[model samples]
Target: MTKLLFIEASPRKENSYSSQVANEFLESYKAANPEDEIERLPLFETELAPLGMEGANQKMENIMKLMTTGSGIEPEGEWAGVMKEIERLKSADKVLLSAPMWNYSIPYRLKHWIDLVVQVGASVMVNEKFEYIGQITDRPLQMILASGSPYENRFPLESDGTKTDFERAYLDHIFRFLGFTDIRLIRVMPTGMPGPQLDEIVANAKKEAKEAAKAF
Candidate 1:
């Protein structure tokens, strides 16, 4: 059976634009594929530990052990919880990530979750020719993003500007590093824009979500 793993990064569930828009996609998807399994991972509900020296050390040791079988490696700290989440991701078939842009970046909790999941020799690795190779589960990824202001795609590096587009570049790079090449982005901009503007944005978001569901 096909499985879809949806990661929700917004603190606000029903109130969040990304959540609302992503649900549109999910609903349309389910209507089309009722037999498919849909799993959700709400970041606000998960306790993701920040990457520490011990976690880094354990990660590095695991990489070395995978590349070489000279000795049995021992992890120094508690990492069962993190590893379990990574294992879940490895076994998934499709991924959907929904988050509202916070200070021009992903939320701290989501970033921590990424840190725990993208481990060397697990998510990616350096090959003998010094080229990077992605080892994580490779599947299509759909990103639903919401921003307080309009997207600054034209001048992402400009000072005193919205950072929604810039955030996508970072997200795409990391996901691509993990061998995910099929990426679709649905963004709701000027989130707090007044009057009919918000409604118009939501309408556009709904259209995008519907299109993404068709493609996915």
Candidate 2:
């Protein structure tokens, strides 16, 4: 049985296009594979404490312990919480993340979670020649995104030297950093645009998401 982890970052819940589409994907995925275990983690409802001095110190200690003693030893103190999150990431056979664009980027809560889970010796490591390597399992990573404005509609960026897709670029890099080679993105673009444009986008997005569910 596959372990599917769905991480939702939108605070809008049912009102969010990304959330709605992701729900559709999960529903179809469940129907197709009855034995697969599906888990939902909503970032807005999660209790994330600030990573202050104590947490950072514990995190450093944990990383050092892993470097010196390896994986058998359990992490202690606040670092244990960080390790628990990483364990969840490692346990999943597939990962789906739903994120709505906030100021052309991801939500703060999701960023906080990323900061906690993406550790030095845990998620990645640097070799003697200074090459970095990600330690997580190589698996399929799927992302559902909702954007208020279409990529082309964002003027300055479209005309700029490089068309920078903040939402996709940031997430794609991060997931790649964690060793996920096969990553896919389903975008519901121009979501908050007026008239039938948004409806059309949403409809197309839903269709794509449904197809992706079966393939996922």
Candidate 3:
């Protein structure tokens, strides 16, 4: 059985288009593959502590212990609670991430989880030949995104972040860094726009979710 990890990054629960669509997709996927090993992780419900110097030191110590014993180790620090979160990422065969774009970027909580999970030896590694040995799970990486505005139209410039397509670049780059070659990005865009546009976008999102469930 494949291990499927669904990570929800949206802070909004009820009105979140991303969450609703993801739930629909997951329900269909579960019905199709009843024996699949599936799990859900909601980032908004989790307390993601920012990395500090003390936490960094403790994480380093944990890494050392893991290297020596080849066993999972949790360090005592601000990061103590996040260790299990990291382990779950490493154990997954397939990963699905859902998040709504905030201020043209990802939510801080999701970024914090990324910081905790994407480790040196676990997610990525450097070989002796100075080449990169990416340790990412050999599975499909999927991202479901909801945006209030149409950032996809404009080009991203460093000066003005308005044009930036944050969800696509950020998540895709991270997954690629960890060795996932294939990525599926589904977007429900321009949500804040009024009238039939919103309904149209949601309808399209639902359709996409149903189609993606088959692949998942």
Candidate 4:
């Protein structure tokens, strides 16, 4: 049975283009694979605590305790709560993140969620050389990134030679660190632009999402 872990990072409901494209992607994916189980985790709905220094220490202590006790069961704390979300990802065959760009980066909630997910000795490991190695493997990650600037077409760079793909670059690095190399990214850009550009961009993104879902 194919399982999909869909992370909804946009809080703007039906009005969010990223959410709409994600819905389209899931709809098409479900139509193509009727038996697939799709799990949607809305970032706004799930209360995710920021992993400050104190929380990080607590998490490390909890992890070591669990390790020594050999329980491997989640404990009652902020870390364990985040671990539960990670467990969901671990159980899935595919992971999809529908996130809108905010200030040339991912949403704060998405960033925070990622911090919780990328824990040492959990999602990654270190060798004697101090090089990090990813623990999660095989699962393909699909990224539906929505930005107001239409980039990643035949011409992604701006006229001023500025790069607009910061979010994807950062996310790709993170996913690759977690041993996910089979990543798919589809963009919905120039949403805030005037005229028919927004509609045109949305339609193209929807089409891309629909097609990508077939193999997703």
Worst 10 residues of 2 by lDDT: 152-161
Q: Write the per-residue lDDT of candidate 1 for residues 105-187, one digit (tens) a residue.
A: 78877888888777666667778897888776458899998888777444256565434355767788888888788888888
Q: TM-scores of the models, in the given order?
A: 0.88, 0.89, 0.84, 0.86
Candidate 1 lDDT for residue 216: 89
Q: Over 4 Å off in model 2, which ranges?
A: 65-74, 152-164
lDDT of each: 0.80, 0.83, 0.78, 0.82
Q: What is model 2's C-alpha RMSD?
A: 3.0
For candidate 4, give the lDDT of residue 195: 68
Stretches off by above 4 angstroms in model 1 are: 70-77, 152-155, 158-165
The TM-score measured for candidate 4 stands at 0.86
In model 1, the worst 10-residue window by lDDT is 70-79
Compose the digit string of candidate 2's lDDT tens values, residues 26-57.
98888888999998899999886467787788
Predicted candidate 3 versus true structure: per-residue lDDT over 1-216, tens digit per residue: 788999999877768999988887888788888888988888889766667887777667666776677654554566665566666887888888899887777898888888877766555665668666667656888788888776653346687544577666788888788788878878888888868979988888888888888877
Candidate 2: the clashing residue pairs are none
**Candidate 4 local lDDT, 1-216, one digit each (tens):** 889999999999799999999999999999999999999899988877657776688767755765576444354566666677667778989999999988777898898888888876677766669788898899899998888875553323456265455687788888888889899888887788756878888888999999999988
